[model samples]
Target: MPTPSEPVDEFDATSSTAADPVLPAGYSMRLLDWADLPAVHALENRLFPLDAWPLSFFEEELAQAVPEPDGGTRDYRVITGPVPGSASGTTATGTAVTGTAVTGTAVIDADRDAGAGEAADVVLGYCGLMCVPPLADVQTIAVAPEAEGHGLGTAMLLWMVAEAARRRATDLLLEVRADNPRAQRLYERHGFEHIHTRAGYYPGDASAQGAGGGRVDALIMRRRLVG
Candidate 1:
């Protein structure tokens, strides 16, 4: 187990995600629908240019909501609304989410407002999880730049842990950038053990955004649950 006291990574915390109860005022979270793909995809490129997932990745995941691996299932969620009382109702670093950016919706969700526009449904963050019984993979979790420093990260992680447990996942797995010390701290707080360091795992030019393959390490973390 990597101790919390261990030195954190030397690089800046790049990725982000957050929770509801711990979120700032005016924040909310719900299952992500096809409508949110455009917004989230844009954010993904911006937030993780090097490792950005292709639009098809989300499409494929959304295609099958119930991925029965002869074991568990899958889950994807997003946080809506902006930070209260702030300009644009989001954190200072928050970027506006507009429907004009991406195209297509995988599933028609009646509960979501089709005409809500970006303001009414400003997205602050999102997360993805896969629970395959004894083995669960945390596909991804991201908090908007504006939503960082708030309790959103902790809240989102806690939610994942609980959700994985609920789906009978005895172990939760995720990979964190070697530079993201803040995220590592958060995971460590939740009893995640750093089991391995994958050399050159993050392949993208470290100096440029949206550039192709470069060398950056990744820390594989795991947590045991009572499921």
Candidate 2:
């Protein structure tokens, strides 16, 4: 609704003592798994209908999470909060799922563990990063409408920054829509600076743009992690 943009946040990668973001109580973050694909895909379509990536896209990205001879190239995380009054977790397809929580972190796998109790977890936000040595790219990041205003966005961003640094990346890059100043400011606050603009990079609806369907420009921003 705020003019679709590839949103991002700031991080002081140069500082060794940068504080990790603290999530609000009752919410937990963990590595994304196959069971989350349906929910994530639904959220993606809801948040960015015009340019939402297909379910297959997410599958491919997750597949790269596996360790290769050259090390894994993808990292994805999901934040989930309890669903009030729900007896059990359900995937997007309405199938029930059981998860195990360990020290404030929950692991949701595709297979159900009998007698795991009735605690339903809902995906509130998700983020992905691609790190390949000298460069890192933010693939996607989004938070549910109801989860906005909290620190979810910033927390996820900090995770990406830390992961990129761990992979020894020298720079981080992302694209934001030119019309979304809020997202731009967030990135700038974390050390990202606009370097280029891709003209008419985002597609717009024909009804909104009149006949030809005007496109939106994308601002390319980068944060240098090292000299």
Please, what is the whole-model Cα lDDT of each candidate in the order they appear?
A: 0.62, 0.66
Quote model 2's TM-score: 0.74
> Number of the top candidate by lDDT?
2
Residue 94 displacement in candidate 2 (angstroms): 25
Tens digit per residue, CA lDDT, model 1, 61-116: 76655534433266788888744334322223432211111111122121242234
lDDT by residue for model 2 (19-95), tens: 34467666777889999999898777656656778899999999998653446789888988753233345322211
Tell me each candidate's TM-score.
0.71, 0.74
Error of 1 at 139 (Å): 0.4
Clashes of each: 8, 2
